[model samples]
Target: MLFRLALAMGRTLQELRATLTYAEFQEWCLYYQIEPWGEDRADLRAGIVASTIANYAGKLRAEGSDPALPADFMPYLERPEPADPSDDRHLTDDELAAWADAAIFGIPPE
Candidate 1:
């Protein structure tokens, strides 16, 4: 059932990005062999949306640098308060689009 449920879920960055927290995102990333960030802080500073996590994942894929998010992203992910943490960390509507401009699509950060 669990496997089926997981299978039922769409296999795309957009799909997985819908329901993820910082902790969950980190765990998922580890499973996919994408480190994108520290385990504890993976999603900690990322946004709770597909675009944010997906952006970083996209960047990693493009860089051909698996096992880690852009080591550069942690700062944004850890931005100070009133900052929507995710928004502060990931910084949507900016370089992310450029970072994720991959040639081909892949599964979510896992």
Candidate 2:
């Protein structure tokens, strides 16, 4: 999802000039993959999403933007743990979408 968000940023800047909806963003990911296969694997897909979050957060810190969230947030975002039946709750899709919005648009989640 985070990768999709970052791709959406690129799409906004280089092509679409408009934000893509979630399904559109998913399609973009599948199309852009080198092999363009096995996107159905939830684990691999989650890893992709988490890495994109890390990349975006790193970019922000490298550029010295106001760090909207905490420094440790990315680690949690990138962790590979299964969200199901865990004591540590994971962010929901809507929450992640808001985070992506913040990364892309420089606004805090409401």
Candidate 3:
């Protein structure tokens, strides 16, 4: 899911994972109307919203008006520094794998 989002947003996976805070990532997903967990028919809803946006853009272009995107359409390029710089340490491989499992599979970290 993150891979697909990265492609759609023209951002690198590392950027998504390391740069954005969890809250920012959630906001980005909400902007795209994609539910990261694929729950509650969210995928279908996102598709409908995307189709609607595309059709609207096409209509605008047909009328000789270029549609402008919202100013806050994209996620922030950088997150603010943590209060404690030491809190910015990189995750270990095992920790990363655990987080991936939790995010992708809904398996709570042990």
Worst 10 residues of 3 by lDDT: 70-79
Clashes of each: 10, 0, 0
Q: lDDT: which is higher, 2 or 3? A: 3
lDDT of 1 by residue, 3-110 (tens): 222444545555555665668755554554443323334544553344466666677475654444443354444332455545546546644554344211221221
For model 3, the stretches where C-alpha displacement exceeds 4 angstroms are 34-110
* Count of backbone collisions in candidate 2: 0
lDDT score for residue 33 of model 1: 46
Off by over 4 Å in 1: 1-8, 11-15, 34-110
Provide the global lDDT of candidate 3 against the true structure: 0.60
Off by over 4 Å in 2: 1-86
- The CA lDDT at 4 in model 3 is 62
* All candidates in order of lDDT, best leading: 3, 2, 1
Worst 10 residues of 1 by lDDT: 101-110
